[model samples]
Target chain A: MRGITITLASLLILTLISVVFANYAHGYMVFGILILAALKFIGISFCFMELKKAHSFWKVGLLLFLVLFMISVLFLAK
Target chain B: MESKILNHKNIYYPPGGILIWIIIFLELITFGIALIVMVFYGQKELEIFHTSRLQLNTTIGTINTLFLITSGYFMARSVSYLRKGQKEKSSLFLKLTMLGGLFFLGLKTIEYYFKIEAGLTVGHNTFFTFYWMLTLFHVIHVIVGLVILTSVLVGLRKNPSKVAIEDVEASAAFWHMCDLIWLLLFPVIYLLF
Candidate 1:
């Protein structure tokens, strides 16, 4: 429960950060928002979904997916 | 032997088991490809994409994000409680999770209504096309997720002792998939372009 609470708080904070960057920070807004989204994604996966307790294979695979997706988004956005 | 394998902490078995994880991965990949395609087209029609995106209500998008995230949190709690043999608490959290989903659908319906009133249908343009396609598909997933959760809730109510943790975990996994997909979609569709 504590873990999930912390995860939820972290996600909310990351979301707030993204919103702030989207509105106030003009340059690298996309970059910042996507990065924050990635963090939120990891938080939900590891803590909320209990991926942290899962096999190393699944954890690493999920991380790889996120990294590849982020790279693609950034490259395309550029 | 198979039950023992499932009960043991094997590398193949995730929280929700291998099958659901496979489905989750497939779903994520599908959405990822669609998003990449949407982004590619957005670059091609930058002006149209930007104008259409500007028509979107970012505030509503953000609120819906909050709703899904909270819903996911509730679901995690539900599963946790069930594991601890606290059926009542688990049921309560499960209901809260469903409520969160309902709230999301309600707000999304309102947003969709406004978009339709403004003539922002799927045929409006390229941007609207992707918007409707991706979001409507996601909405369908959320509705399916709700049905699954409802069934789980009923099972818990009917026979708590007979409820399988694996089943609850599977349902929770599916619910979180909706949250995960939205996390991917919201920023890209609403904020990125």
Candidate 2:
């Protein structure tokens, strides 16, 4: 519980910082920060969703899903 | 049987079972495609996308993201406590999780009302189209998630032991997916250009 709380707090603080930065960012910086957001999404799934303790199938499956999602979102954003 | 074999060792089994994992993966793919398509369309009208994003309330989106994430934390703890056989503590945490969802829904209603009053309906423009469709769909998911959690709460009172572990884990998994999707949706629909 402590670990999860700390992780959530850290992610929130980092997300706020990233959001503020992304708001004003231009060029590649925008997508870069969005990628940070994607990472946070994956991190939350791993921790909060208990995917860390889940089977290898799920661990691998989620990783692939998010990777493809991030790639598609970023690649198609232009 | 294959089912028994799969569920036996539990080494290769997902928490909520293979069915929910399949559902989660399928849902992720579906939303990923939808969002990617929306962004692809958005690029053609960058001017409208940028301007429309400004009308969105970033603070509210941020708040909801925090709420969902906190709720997710509570949910994970609830499952952990339940597995530990702490029924009362688990029930309390689950209720907290539901409260967070209610807060999110109330704020989202206000945000929608503000948008609708401002004439930002789906047909108003392309960007609003994407905004309304994605977030409304997500809102439905949240509602369903709440229903699932409510069922869990009720079942806990009747007989926590009688409730299948898969059922609770499935609800927990669905709730986590809501948080995950909102985290993805918030920046794209509310913040990004």
Off by over 4 Å in 2: B1-12
Q: Give candidate 2's whole-model lDDT.
A: 0.83
Deviation (Å) of B70 in candidate 2: 0.3
Q: DockQ numbers for every candidate?
A: 0.72, 0.59
Candidate 2 reference-contact recovery = 0.54
TM-score between predicted and true chain B, model 1? 0.96
Q: TM-scores of the models, in the given order?
A: 0.96, 0.93
* lDDT for residue B15 in candidate 1, whole number 0-100: 90
Q: For model 2, how does the per-residue alpha-carbon lDDT over B1-193 read when each residue is reduced to its tens digit?
A: 0112235125546776677778777877877788888889888998998899889998998888888888988998998888777889999999999999999999999999999999999998999998999999999999999999999999998877677666788899999988888877887787667
lDDT of 1 by residue, A3-76 (tens): 89989988878877787788788788888999999999999988889998888889988999999998999999
Interface RMS for model 1: 1.3
At residue A3, candidate 2 shows an lDDT of: 83
| Residue A63 CA displacement from its true place in model 1, Å | 0.9
- Go through the candidates in order and give each one's C-alpha lDDT: 0.91, 0.83
